[model samples]
Target: MASKYPRRQFLGQLAALGAAVTTVPQYARAMESTLFAPAGEKSFVPVMITPFTSDLKIDYKGLSALTDLYLASGAKGLFANCLSSEMYYLSDEERLELVKHVVKHVNHKVSVVATGSFGNNLTAQAEFAKKMHQTGVDGVILITSHFASREESDDVMMTNIDKFLALTEGIPLGTYECPSPYKRILTPATFKHLIDSKRFIYHKDTTLDQAKIKVKLDLCRGTGLQFYDAHAPNGVFSLQNGAKGLSCIAGNLYPEIFSWLCENVNNPARSADVSWIQEEITRLDDVIGNGYSLNARYVLNKRGLNLQVVNRASKSPLTAEQIKISDDVYKTVLQWHERLGIKV
Candidate 1:
């Protein structure tokens, strides 16, 4: 179903969000208990992609439609304005507007988190995070790269992270090892630091290595932080070994498959089906990365969203072969929907 909140209500909420920036602690605490995910529950949180108009403006109508599709497809939450949303390419104001739109359109029906730490310094990051918190997001996600340089030691990163934590005070936080600006795969020690902070409620892991994932999961076993694997091929393994759920690029195309995998992967009776679907996801995952967000747009359009295949992150247009691959993958998703009895 579409958002019950109409355009008028959304604009009102956006204005409220702007004014509420001054009262962050009170508003954030009011929603924290309901917004934060409890430990041990599985989720499919799509790293949302921003849709653009032909003239390169934000296509808000398309964004709202996409959000509704995710909700209908069984997404447990939303990760908005992140790398998948082309955050780097978006202006700071545009990022806030995009997130506010999603949060209002979602009407607090599900948890929402957006990347907020964007400045060159920790103070700037904290200030922006507070502003983002006012947008009614469940939490503000900090990029791992923002805390440390590629050549810097973990200690340097920790020092910076500690400072940022102190600066932000009451705002809830999460971390993402975003691929751009170089991916900072968190070491177990660094991961432990975040868990121990009692501030981080989310962690999106990109270290496709399952052994490392297992160790980190053990560390965060009882911690409230929800660990999500960004690698789609490891979806089954990560979920089986106790990661909260998937937060991968593939969700941008067919979130229903991820939602179904999260719901049924642990069932003994569904083991065979699980294995088959995992293989399918792994193969399609590889294909989806070729043209990336553009190919993803193609698949979504094929599914009837009719989004303009425009992205600020990459100017590379999808090749003919890439479009063919996307078509095949769309058919595969349809087949999964039929076999799994997933209603579209």
Candidate 2:
């Protein structure tokens, strides 16, 4: 069945096939510029920020110090104004200020990913995304519209995403899939379509469903989009499944611990070490994470991080009983921290 063609021409055809195999979409090329280092280059472990102060103002000094601490602790990057960062309670100006400060503090030690989600307003969120890119940040994390059951909400989210991509030019983008706070879920098909659009280069999977996580991982394969587990309590298993990295609020308090767990998770010889850390972290989560309440913050403060225990002034303060319970939990975590050789 071999046809008589010149050997040189046949070789050229094979080369062309190789090039075609490697080619990526133009938009994806642009997105990849800021996405995690080209796939297989290096995996990144990012810490989500939790900015708070007693006066309800953005803690500029504390934020700067924390940013420095995380980078020094071997974190690969920072995600500002995310769920852990309490983005909902912040004003537009305060959000921008936090992004700017984190950018300045990080000073290129690691990439900065800023959250651009706001209440169902695509235009405004796009504007913020554009500004974030202009400030030299690497990426924006967009949350789908909250609590909207309408088909129109999906349309709005898609349109807004398109607008944001167009406006940011070459900035990378990430999507945060947090089902608890947002009533609507982005189905597997819809998620694949978005990734196919080449606008987003990452997905922060906060949904704890193993089945859904597998779907996202399958759909994102070969697209060069990175997936991270925001559900830290389940992160070890998530990484084993397919997550490229970990991004969690727990990283705010135990940056080095999370960083070590991530590095060890990838090395077969270190599985035992990672298992020990994961077990301790899971125990802490059992006591503090159930309510998503004050216990986590109090534990952070007790360890000398000075994070405000209150969620947000705009939201109701933690009840007295909740505060007392949180304090008890904080003491217990501190004891464990010392036992584990984690610095307070």
Candidate 3:
């Protein structure tokens, strides 16, 4: 089959995603979520950041602007109240309102989902998930099961997921491998069972390892569960192996590039071209992992967007060294975008 993606027009900005695409097995080429949106919908979904005023107030104005920015730029969906939004730090009221605001503002122009389960116990998590569903989000995402010890077993998690399913009726469910308090990389067997169980329809994968990602994608191959790649370093590789979409934090910054990559993973075009483009994305991903919120604010400011007011418990201003590094990367990123003819 030939790729509908025009070779020269798209993926012209980034450095080199070519080598990375070659890592994709010739056999592992899937781009659609079997049970979700039809072909040509947005696949690069960004876990949105909560914009705040300098005084630490929820910046509704900023949120509105950011929301508009994402929609105008061709985002197929919006995910809110996730770790990228700093879910652990937000109060119940804030989380609910923010998800509501994003869903309502997006106005069904795109799919919407949010992480409603905070540090609350499983029962409370379920209740809150239902409330979030009432806010009109397409799905309510749950935090990864936390264990005081990382030695917890799949059997134990299976029992817990059952309880979550019992509580969250009527509303759809998703899971995130959020690493804040603790992170659980669901075992391949457990993930296959989760997909077979018919309760979970979404997964935010953080394994960050291509080998493991391949196993998970294999599990959900014929199911409706859409696996989103959370880790950025191997993002393009995962896409080739049939990750339904990308839930990368970088999407908020450069959605056009993300969308272009997502649009062409299964392209019948030159594999070298695809691999080089993926390498460039991984390069940007390297720059992003340095710092999450602060780095984003710095770039957003450079792009004439808003600054963040909320701070992590140990948050401090980005050091001069950090600022210079981010600015240099930012400059290169902007140049790349210009070369691709993407409107900022």
Q: Against the true structure, what is each candidate's TM-score? A: 0.90, 0.76, 0.84
Off-target runs (Cα >4 Å) in candidate 1 are: 1-40
lDDT of 3 by residue, 188-286 (tens): 887877776666667999898788889898988767678889876676787878777888888766666677677766677745555766777787776
How do the residues 104-202 of candidate 1 rate in per-residue lDDT, one tens digit apiece? 899878889998887867788888888888887878898887888889999999999999988888777889988777788999999998888888878
* TM-score of candidate 1 against the unseen true structure: 0.90
lDDT value for candidate 2? 0.63
CA displacement after TM-score superposition, residue 91 of candidate 3 (Å):
0.7
Tens-digit lDDT track of model 2 for 1-344: 11111110000111234644864443455443534433443244554555567766677777776676677667776777676666665676777777888777767766677766553344655666767665656667776543233456566666666766666655567777655344345778768768877767667776778788888888877775778887777778877777778887666555666766666686877777678777887776655554453455555556566666665623666667767767776665566556555563
Give the winner by lDDT. Answer: 1
Error of 2 at 76 (Å): 1.1
lDDT of 3 at 65: 82
Worst 10 residues of 2 by lDDT: 5-14
Superposed model 3: Cα runs more than 4 Å off: 1-36, 40-42, 146-149, 270-272
* Residue 123 of model 1, lDDT score: 83
Question: In candidate 2, which residue pairs clash?
Answer: none
What local lDDT score does residue 332 receive in model 3, on the 0 to 100 scale? Answer: 71
Question: Between which residue pairs do clashes occur in model 1?
Answer: none
Give the top-scoring candidate (TM-score).
1
